[model samples]
Target: MTSPGRTERLVLPGVLTAEQAAHTVAAIAAEQRPDGAIPWFRGHHLDPWDHVEAAMALDAAGEHTRAEAAYRWLAAHQNSDGSWYAAYADGAADEPTDRGRETNFVAYAAVGVWHHYLATGDDAFLDRMWPTVYAAVEFVLQLQQPGGQIGWKREDPEDGGIDRTEALLTGCSSIHQALRCALAIAEHREEPQPDWELAVGLLGHAIRSHPERFADKSRYSMDWYYPVLGGAVTGAAAKERIEERWDDFVVPGLGVRCVLPNPWVTGGESCELALALWVMGESDRAVEILQWIQHLRAENGLYWTGYVFEDRAVWPEELTTWTAGSLLLAAAALGGDEATTAVFGGERLPVGLEPDCCTQP
Candidate 1:
């Protein structure tokens, strides 16, 4: 049963009719290639992370065939080592000079596949994609450092070397959630993944113990809440992290800032923050954040990438597919949808880490 508020506002409400969402879904569907890949924007290159995001959006909007095609594209293009290239151009897998493999980007497929499976309850789809997801997680784990943080990427063209630095808090946090999902998938299949459990514990440790190991990225909202959002941290500490930064980045009726005092609040980050809040069991605050972005919607359901501090819009200057997708996922979480709830696992939050990393003065 859909909540009255969700039905009123997003479904039957005057803000966005079901027909409008259907049109938006069709527009997104039209962006996919004949091969089932969706590019970041029309006439732009496609990458794994954004492709999965767009695919999940399609799934959310009831375009399952297109979503499956998008996943098939990843499976077809996956490298022998269980990874995809950093980028592709003109639908060809050309190895660019800076073709460094991003660990977090590659691991994002697990979340997407699991999400699709939940939304559709397609066990066969889950079975078919399980190996691809398993291998991809293993590939990402190869880059994990001793401190439990995975390195940013491999093969930096500028440095002409592998950038084997300590784990980034944001990347590790995201990967931590991916590992948990991968493990759950393994369990569902009656398979064992001891390696995955080890990886999860290590990454959780890094998120809890190694704040100094991360790059100095305190200004970004990702660094502020991603650990909690990603299920790498939780409980009272997660709540404190949000409360501490609440006034710093949140502009009334504008949305959350990408960076503090930087005149740029983004829909993506704000929506993710709302999701994180939901993860921490604060549904009322999460709803408030989601509603704040309502003012930022364009004539179409699409949204600008970010809003300027002057209370103006900026960057890309066009509507984005992922922006709407993020909003939909956040809304689903807030409404206690079964698919969203199952993926997030009852909102108890992950219990393996402390949230004190960003609490320092």
Candidate 2:
């Protein structure tokens, strides 16, 4: 029933077979255009967040050049305000089908840039990327609401600018993690971005204390686990949060659902949840979560995006770059890769100045 993609490569020791991890890395790199742009797939569109995710996976696999190329592609295409359009055609196209700019999507560049630097220890690469990360962070913070929650997207002026200032809990949690990575980069470079430090603190506060400031997107799985995965939610609070929705988003053998009350299980969300569980120190459960999603694996070592259990079919029919990237990242985290542990587990990244003591630190 699975479609073949490519032969498996080197899998890791425990978390994944060397071949599995290698195939995932190769799948993503194989999809990169000559310009270093990696689409969701060969012919799909490239969004900054997923593009960064795939690039990070490439870095994990020691494909530093390809990863840097991906970042360069992003740098060359970035809008003047440090943002990228929501989507672009697979190649080096400058035009976007959607002109709206997303804060989380734009802000995630910092995470990838920092991760790439950590993986490669390339100071020059970091220097090249700091400006892009700085501009993107500045662009993201420009839309931060007074409540400290960031707006999801700045609507196109023609589409009603002020009316589109709404924010999302999942997106803010993601941005919260990105801000921490940005601060880490700042600290590593000795640039001392006080504003980014303050933003990181405030963003953590918003994620912890001001849930009301964000839109109610509880139906989605990312909303359930992202706070923990993003390092915004931790300790007893993170455990409590996961326990509260464990039944809602998880299926026994299928993996995490993309949404509640849905029979669809997605590879990305499931792998993300595995990473969250690893962060919580539940290695047994996290391993089980990864094992449960093996059904999504294809003969070629790539994975299907999601499966519809009710219909017993693979939906969307695409082996997306980010889905595999998420899986590799989660595996690397579990397999004790230093850079990955530092990036996702928040072990090495510097947490900047503390904000209002409204919640756990």
Model 2 off-target regions past 4 Å? 1-15, 157-163, 356-361
Each candidate's lDDT (Cα)?
Answer: 0.73, 0.84
**Candidate 1 pairs with clashing backbones:** none
Give lDDT tens digits, candidate 2, residues 1-361.
1111212222433446655666667778788888888888887788889999988888777788899999999999888878888888765544687778999999999989988888889999999998999999999999887667888888765576443578898898899889989989988888888887777777788888888888899999999999999999999999999999999999998899998788999999999999999999997788888888888888766789999999999997998889988988887777776678888899777666656664445
**C-alpha RMSD of each candidate structure in angstroms:** 4.6, 3.5
Candidate 2 backbone collisions, by pair: 9-19, 10-18, 10-19, 11-17, 11-18, 11-19, 12-17, 12-18
Per-candidate TM-scores read 0.87, 0.93
lDDT at residue 62 of model 1 (Cα atoms)? 58
Q: Provide the lDDT at 306 for model 1.
A: 80
Please estimate how well model 2 matches the true structure, expressed as its whole-model Cα lDDT. Answer: 0.84
What TM-score would candidate 1 get against the native? 0.87
> For residues 1-361, what per-residue lDDT tens digits would candidate 1 score against the true structure?
1223323223423234565555556666666788887875665666777788778767666577888999988888887777776777644543332367788888988878887887788999999999899889988999877666888887644567466665678888888877777777787788987777777777887776678878878888898989887876678888888889888888877789898668888888888898898888887777778777776677655667787868564765766667777776676666565656655543432233323443344
- Count of backbone clashes for each model? 0, 8
- Give the worst 10-residue stretch by lDDT in candidate 1: 1-10
